[model samples]
Target: MNVGEWAGLVAAAGSILGGGGWFVSRATRDAARATAAATEAAARANAAPAQQQASLAVLEATVKRVDEENGSLRGKMSRLEAVLRAFAWTTDRWSQQMHRAGIEPEPPHPLVEEYNRTGV
Candidate 1:
């Protein structure tokens, strides 16, 4: 081949190789960026469920604690109510006994009579 034709062919080949290299480099860079974004998104997606589960666990624990406290308070109230009933029964018996012994039994208070009437 002539020197001029050979030189022209070499130049054309160099230009094509340079363009192809530039395109390949750009494609590789774009692919790498996309992969990185996907990895970050996947990490966030995986973390979301764990975060929700942790929050739910905390809420469940709080509910259980509140239920336990409510039950304890109810038990204490039941015992208090029983004691009050026993005291009222004993006081009523004592009043009746005093009346039978010739002692002047005081008249019941208006509030007491009202409560007794209502059975409250």
Candidate 2:
């Protein structure tokens, strides 16, 4: 072949080699990205159970705390009810004794009348 033909052949061969190298490089990058994504997905999958256990533990602790608060509230309510019962008995006895002694008892205020009508 002449020199010009030889040069053209060399240029063509170089372009083919470069195109093949570019394709290989692109394929390698895509494969690497896919591998990294799969690895991240696997890690997340492995951690899911532990994350669920942690959430469950938090829920259990909250339930236990609410149960304890309810127990304390119940005790407080029981004490208040006992005090109210004692007060009612004392007031009834005092009024009866005052009436027997011929002394009139003071009338209840309007607010006290409403409380007596309503449970409040």
Residue ranges of candidate 1 with Cα displaced over 4 Å: 1-44, 107-111
C-alpha positional error of residue 26 in candidate 1 after TM-score superposition, expressed in Å: 18
Question: lDDT of each structure?
Answer: 0.92, 0.91
The clash count of every prediction, one per candidate, is 0, 0
Cα lDDT tens digits, model 2, 1-120, are: 999999999999999999999999999999999999999999999999999999999999999999999999999999997887687668768989999999999986776566557746
Q: Candidate 2: which stretches are off by over 4 Å? A: 99-106, 109-111
Model 1 score (lDDT):
0.92
Best by lDDT: 1
Compare the candidates by TM-score and give the number of the best one. 2
lDDT of 1 by residue, 1-120 (tens): 999999999999999999999999999999999999999999999999999999999999999999999999999999997887787788799998998998977888887777667756
